[model samples]
Target: MIASTIKTQYEGSSHDSVLYSKPYSKKIDTLNMPKGYQLPKFMQFDGKGNLKQHVTHFIETCNNAGMEEDYLVKKFVRSLKGNAFDWYTNLKPEFINSWDQLEKEFLNCFYSTRRTISMLELTSTKQWKDEPIIDYINRWRSLSLDCKDQLSETSAIDMCVQGMHWGLHYILQGIKPRTFEVLATRSHHIELSIANHGKKEPITDFKKDKVFAPNIDKIGKKPAKEAFTVNTTPIKTSSTPIKIDVIKDSTQIKPSF
Candidate 1:
């Protein structure tokens, strides 16, 4: 009646069996168990030829308690994801070089009080299903109307373009991105466009016509003013009279008689 009560209380659970069942496991020379020995405890030796106590204990414990191998493998894989490799290989060099600095800059750009990049930077060592880089970027802000409008503003585009320029530089050189050069180039373009966008007083404004003549700024000579010859002398005329002698004088004398 007592055995039946114990059986009823413990049931068939492994924990119950380990605690209540008679000690069925016997300590044998686990080091020299023959091939035919049924359920012989397995053992492992370290490089120094010493038998590891933990291995023997764990095997005996698991066999006594009925632990399976699949559960052990799952736990192992989870551990490898955290400790196997450095996570920064998949990220930009600049970000990896000075994570703290980049985190600060990223925070400045974050919208909706989000810290997506910061979190990834902190947690990338763990294994996960592969995702594209931009997916990682867009995590901080949702694709809502206000977010899109904020991203479309002048300051935002300028920041993005500048960020892209530096990011490319970092990728190409495999080094930390230099903010000075990138920001300088951005500032210069902004100032130039702001100064020369619309007010037209002709400073390198050569886009007036398609075909242009060289040296248009310098004035050319009007072909030598048609050279002319002039005689400046005044004409002198004489006041002279010419007398005509009449040959009819002989006829007139005869008529007079």
Candidate 2:
């Protein structure tokens, strides 16, 4: 009757359900499974034995992140062990831990910027515009204007690497929840790099100080000399200089009525 009752109530017409089904006993069901089923029950603890909330949090977080549940579980477990796991989590932040997530995000940012800079250079240069992919990549240096002064080389390279990481990480984070701080930190690093490398060719120099000033020679000394000469000649020919007498007013008004 107990077997029949279990079959009638819980078993879903599948024998596999008996062996692998989620905990039926209320006792085991109460405790959350370890991460990725990754760590032993011990590692999740802090010095005080406050079990790390990482495992339960990761599963819920990943499901909310729109990740495949199995994949999320596997990835989380992997993170507990080594770098490969770290890489996956870094590549998928909402599903995993922070360390790898940050690294991947940073790289993604860098790669995208590099591609953008490369594309801009190709369009600007005559030869690379219609060239094959191989040609464009290979001749990037020549095609690209020397942007070194405008942006720093190191910053540009670092940002490119960061961009690569972010691109992957964002799949889990989505377009909205990802903080601007994350985006900005990535973007600023890229901009700094582009600025250091001086490679961003926006085709405009509206930054003010770069604009040319009026020439002093053309505007000031020569024009004044020409005005003076013409006036002097005309004044001499016109008539004798008129003399005027100045009278001093003695009375001063103390206040308006």
Candidate 3:
């Protein structure tokens, strides 16, 4: 009877285990998602300004990764380093709860009014000596974005042309490009033309003789001076029959009668 009871208990346990058994499912690793699909390293905010760029990049990166608002807030806080981390930790619990609120506060803390003024001043930027036209244009365009008022395409093209080197600017002026795209294309061609022209050897008129040439005879000798032997004696003539001899040197004549 004891052997039979143990056998029956064993059979019942086996049946229960089979009924409760689950198939193994592979666990998904969030950190090691497909190669390029993995989350990017968090961008740390330094207090040196450019808060807009830093925050924008962070938001864009998180959005691309399909991170939810909660994850966004957590990742942003985790990414902070040094003073930034300390400042964030000290914020009220409510302030840290909303990602949008956090971003707004972050910008308020870092973005300065002076930066906007500086951006406005960029409209007056002139091309620096030896600065490339393309570089000047690119810098102006970048600064324009930071301004409170965005620059129009025509205004941007004008600013770019105005900042260009005088030589290039003069050439582009004649082309009279109505659009920024046209201006850029024309400027590129002009720049290449100038560069190619500089590389060329200037054509010479070998046909014309040089004004100054080496005189082998006069190399070491002093220039000759004129000497005249004048005849002071009056001529003795009978009925205008008198012979006069004139001696000529390099610069004067001596007469004998």
Candidate 4:
């Protein structure tokens, strides 16, 4: 009885020092890779992607490789990298006793914080002045997924439209697509048409020295006086023949009748 108790204490000590339970460690230690079984490529979660997605993908890959709960619980830490690895290392020993508990803790640790950050990003995200319709819409939709609890299709459309450039928004306002998909499609169509054809620019015809309106500064200044001037004050004329004398180089003309 004393020997069995000592063995239990030793096993419990081993389990309490790591992530897996004592039973999980025992099963995982005895398991061998199947003959010709190649290790499946595990996804490295660095905390950038959706936490739930990362966990789901990790489980799927491990399951496909015939890893049962024991292996999953024991080996999940191997898949972590960067911030995720740091998070795993900081977990209290023996706190996570099963695969489900570990997965739950992983989600609880990262998911809410990520969603909050994503929500802020979504609120502040804007379509760049030169960004294409396809690219901007794609990015906006991706950000929405992280914070999409209350986001409806109409609200999604509104958010995208609000983030779009004013010129794009003006055109989109006129089109008034009813659904987000239709909006994306029509926006892309607008983009393609603009690319294939072009925007209408006002064609202005110009001529030099024909300005009806002068420069604002120039308009305030009086014209310079001319050296030569012609005077025609109804020159005295008998209804008969009158001769007006003028020289080629003269400035003023005097008519005599």
Top-TM-score structure, candidate number = 3
lDDT accuracy of residue 58 in candidate 2:
51
lDDT of 3: 0.63
lDDT by residue for model 2 over 160-240, one digit each (tens)? 233233422333133221333444354334334334444533322222314333333555454222212111222232556
| Tens-digit lDDT track of model 1 for 1-257 | 88977877657446654554211112211123334444423332221221223234534544454433322211111111221212211223223223233233323432233223442232232212343223322332232222323333333323333333332323323322235344334334433433454453223222231332233455776654443334333334475433333232333211110
Pick by lDDT: which candidate is best? 4
Q: Give the TM-score of candidate 1.
A: 0.14
**What is the Cα-based lDDT of residue 164 in candidate 1?**
38
Q: Over 4 Å off in model 3, which ranges?
A: 1-40, 93-95, 112-114, 117-120, 128-135, 176-257
Candidate 1 lDDT score at position 45: 24
Q: What is the C-alpha RMSD of each candidate to the true structure, in Å?
A: 26.3, 20.9, 18.0, 13.4
Question: Each model's C-alpha lDDT?
Answer: 0.32, 0.36, 0.63, 0.69
**Candidate 4: tens digits of C-alpha lDDT, residues 174-221:** 666778788887777556644543444222112121223222354566
- Count steric clashes of candidate 1: 0
Tens-digit lDDT track of model 3 for 1-257: 88878987766556654554211112211223334556677778756656777778888888788775545665676567777775675564343545666777777776544456364487578888877777777777777776777677776677668778887877766666777667766676667666655666232212241233333365577767656555544566775544444444544434444
Candidate 1 has an lDDT of 0.32
Alpha-carbon error at 216 in model 1, in Å? 3.3
Could you tell me the lDDT of residue 61 within candidate 2? 59
lDDT of 3 at 182: 72
Off by over 4 Å in 1: 1-154, 159-215, 221-257
